[model samples]
Target: MGGVGHWVVIFAIGGAQAVLLALALWRRPVNRAANRVLAAWLGLVGLDLGVKAAFLAAPAPGLFRVLLFVGVFPFLYGSFFYLYVRTLTTARRLAWLDGVHLSGFAVAFAVGLPALLAAPDTNLANMQAWLAGAFPPPVPWYSPFLYAWSLSYVAAAVWRVLRFRREVRERRSDADRVSLHWVMAMAMGQVLIWGIAVVHDYVRPAGIGYFTIYGAVAVWACVLGYLGLMQATVAGDDTAEPGAPREVPPDPPAAPPAQDEDARLPEVQARLAGLMEDEAMYLAPALTIAQVARRSGYPEYLVSAAINRGFGCTFWDYINRQRIAAACRCLADASDTRTILDIAYACGFTSKSTFNSAFKRETGHTPSAWRARQAAA
Candidate 1:
């Protein structure tokens, strides 16, 4: 594609990102604060890409360059992204100290403000000089600092994702398909892009590498938008107190006496089965592994391990199995005149689609089909 075509493509991607951000903000997700933070991060990204596309297409001299200078720092974007992931995973609100992450951007902006406020001719002249390989601007000295800031936040984000994954294994059954994976992918993508930009700066000044980086960024925005649309939105109690126990990491199984180890497994299995069968704890739509552990008076890891070993499924699948079984009973009851949705809700399903899928997956037929078969029999 020609320059205009490329610019059009970038702008289109940026526009889509903005729309996705709006959708995320509009929805009342379970974690509203996290959703808003993510929307803000996406907004910054969209603004950055949109401005870059405009500059590329028009190539204005003074004001445009100043705008580019202000918009190009990825530090703020990195901080927002890290905070979004942290809040989403931890179910925590932003703290006052989080503002410190943007201090680098603030300092950089202040340092560059004089040039931006200089006479239009002087600003244009400086731009030409920089383009012509004259003395580098003060901004270049801060390049390493900016990169370091971005990398540190990306590292923090990755760490948070890893911790979240560990907690999910301990506390969630359907952990494999959770939304955290998308956040992990996005963080890794940022690392790769930033790494490439660093290499481009040191190895070659051809300026072509920047286009490649920006193009990758545009593509990343599209991917994020698509994932945001497809992924399930979290919906639950948003009143969790700050520093509340959001997740508990699984503890490693302690070594027992050789005979005790073998006997302990069956005991754990019995307790878990009793909790599900007798107590009917699976009826809670928001039931979690941690909750089950607390109810059964067992350690969270032991409960998860028991379910995994005895049922050969994740905590999510095991609970869903119980729910589906309960749903089957309701579906087969001729006296229960309730609708499918009502039955789904009674069986602890949060959404109709989730209920339908789980029912079909467990039983070889949809709820309606199963009901029809029961009537026929």
Candidate 2:
């Protein structure tokens, strides 16, 4: 039948992509890896659109579009899968491999060498036959290779999430389940999009072309990402309601309106920083919002307000930053006389697992590795 259905899906999908990329850029302090990966993925999206344009207008449409859609785009999918997980979980961890990532850039240079060359435009039937015979869905070799590269990253991210979930559940540690949910949300989105694409490849019907298949798949992705972002915004609020009255000293005029975000933010940041430097609220065995606020001569309500508005990190991440910050000192100091558990507890973390996870979040390296690096230096 036809390609390029309606104006709405185009605007809708494009809007969703822009919103996600914007939110990721605005909210995350550690999103460089995700940013790089998203940039590459977006570039692929552009390439997909370009090939579809060529399919409509080119005299050799069958050849050029087939080569691009089958061989080139499939390889790009491999890179996209790797980057999406890397974007969500370990942007910092992969920073060292920047040089290796750059080496792949010199791949185009290899085409000039005798043994290497770029792909030529091929017939649609021949390309389809090539994909069907050699590189099928879950291609055993192709699809799974991208997945294998993500395996360790997935495991590490899952461990942090589950570990954080356990801590929030037990009330023994400060990390929350929100971050866990965020990671899981991203994983589910990836699986759903990729899963449909794989299924469509085999169960192909006559009129459902490559552009339509990818367009359909991307529609689902945009929907899921939109829903996830909406939930993240709601869940990020520390207070139950935006304009609800805060815990006051039983006085009406003395307390300001609950949602005075701009007026309170600087005060919150400074007070929270003071609590961190002075009381070392981070190092307490069971630090509570009540305790920190009281120590700072403020209400617990005000403290939560400060945390949510000023830092944008949850109370969990906020306190963990302090504990993790302390852990860095012990890590750097080289305590021959102390154990990791001791350092962990001393830094206000209740358990080794919590300490290890939080340390990784703050520094991207494990505490032992950090210490070793210092020692090596």
Candidate 3:
């Protein structure tokens, strides 16, 4: 506890910031449901940090009770994380069944309450001995089980985000605009924090004390706060609405039993080309495979298959290629006075970073470099 004062300051600052951010998120109008859950999670994390700070600054007489209370937070953290992701990805209201996720906290609270009635001196002695590293802390017997349970939910949340990314690409041309990469990074950060906690607690890693663990937690809180506020709801655009009823294109005529997919593959490819080349459908910023299928009078699957099998690229990639080609033409036009960002928007890219990356990837040069080369040539 020699450096305990420094850690107390770190925890207090992080806790205060987390609590403030949580309040701001709670009142945020956009993505109210998801934000509220995120708010609660952040608030809980802040409170947890505050408690740790207090306990470290002044060891409590009822150390057993405090430890038990803090131990139960993992269950809530995992449950809240899952629920927050669900609200963001699915936009569905939580059912009463969702309350089942909190049962672990309830059980742990009930089982540990009796220990709170133990004599203060006994709890204090245990706390002192534990702090001195001469004896193990009064950790609940179910702690290991709780860790596994929480990680299961974290794994589920990661799976959900990944699935969302895969599914969004099939439906939206501007999938990059609604990226969930931040969510993936945040989930990984949680896993790292959990790993550090486990190693510090069990392995007692050299130079990794309670301060190191809480310092990580504090950093994590700041990151979570920033990302949670910055993230947009999946429903930000009407065309990209997660809960919208997707329109299915009309079914095609039945083919003969001898006819394979190759029979209609040409037609699908032709229709896809017509949509992109003739209709300039790639210029729609919010264009989707469904829109292409509807315009081409082909099923979405057929359109997708044509893009994938014929062009050897995803619908997103094919569309980006078309856009990049159009952008190249624009970049090469000396008479076109539009800025790069203007060209990006005109080429159906909603984000400059996405546009720049796509342009560089496709042509091996940034948009500016491409323009300069064309000018010099």
Candidate 4:
């Protein structure tokens, strides 16, 4: 009965991974780095399943199952760690050994050193003996230390998200809030999975009891990878501090949710139209959200919200689009009397530096290059 149940559980676990990998491949707006990591995990799991299934015809030793289980845990855990961070912080850099967090994870995963060098451990007794002498038997301290360290990594992530939530509350921009909240959800869910694994590690039977959580761990791995693959769609709130969420906590309210969804969109589109009509908002040297909102007649809160949610851009980007549109108009009219600076100031830009930056980001060229190219054509 136990054997039958374990097979059923394994099948479910494998099936879940397959579905997630498929989703990762198909989902658009994916982060390329995330996609690669997920695809790799999918392949690894496929290989693991293939080996286990091949052994079905001639049942392998229970020790073999234990070893496979131990090995799979780290692979899946690492996948979860990568995918979750990749998805939540798309466009942000996360070096493999960015800091103490990942380094600690690397150390924790190195715990299985003994099983590698010992001659084929055909059974539990041999495996135990090999482990006992392998670098002095793991004391009770090892188990607790590992558990605390793993949990702390997740807890720290939660703390970061909650901090973002607080900042979002002040802005009250719907788009800003929504993006932060989405990231918060992904972070918290990942943290919950880690919490479960840490608890299992603490309470499980000495040998491989915690491996049971390995199957549950797949749930998070799949979700995290899916998030990574669809990261393009997941918004990062503009109001958020430059860094992404580092912890899971209550996020501020979602950007003011529209009671009339369709109506809200049109209203925002109208605001975008207005931003294009003026040179003042575009030319402001140090235009901030408050200033933009004051000009738009929409609350800075609403203007910021619309920029984030309706336009899918930050206020900085939103302002630049207007400046670029105005510049294009000037180019088409063949106006030479107005120096670029004159035109930039006429468009509401206060500084050449600001206007130039906006123009380059939007048009993929400096203002001078853009004008020269247009004239040549």
lDDT of 3 at 153: 88
Residues 70-153, candidate 3, lDDT per residue (tens digit)?
A: 756776888888998888888665789899989877776776665555577766676676567564433556657667877888
Regarding lDDT, does 2 or 3 come out ahead? 3
The residue-level lDDT of candidate 4 at 57 comes to 28
What is the lDDT ranking, best to worst?
Answer: 3, 1, 2, 4
Q: Candidate 1 residues 1-377, lDDT tens each?
A: 23456755776577567756656664645466777777676776777777766655655675456554745467686787788887777667778887897887888788777776767798787666644536354666777887888889888988888877766655664455553767877887888888777887778656446567777778777776555545443423464654567555566557556465456778888888888889899888767887888888766656776787767877878888888999999889999999999998888877777788888898999999999999898
Evaluate model 1: give its lDDT. 0.73
Number of residue pairs clashing in candidate 4, backbone atoms closer than 3 angstroms, sequence gap of 3 or more or interchain: 20
**CA displacement after TM-score superposition, residue 324 of candidate 2 (Å):** 28
For each candidate in turn, give its C-alpha RMSD to the true structure in angstroms. 7.5, 18.0, 4.1, 16.5
Off by over 4 Å in 1: 1-5, 12-16, 23-30, 129-140, 205-207, 233-269, 273-287, 294-377
Candidate 4: lDDT of 256?
55
Task: Give the lDDT of residue 4 in candidate 4.
Answer: 37
Best by TM-score: 3
TM-score of each: 0.65, 0.41, 0.83, 0.46
Q: Name the better of 3 and 4 by lDDT.
A: 3
TM-score of 1: 0.65
Off by over 4 Å in 2: 1-36, 53-93, 96-160, 163-177, 202-212, 220-377
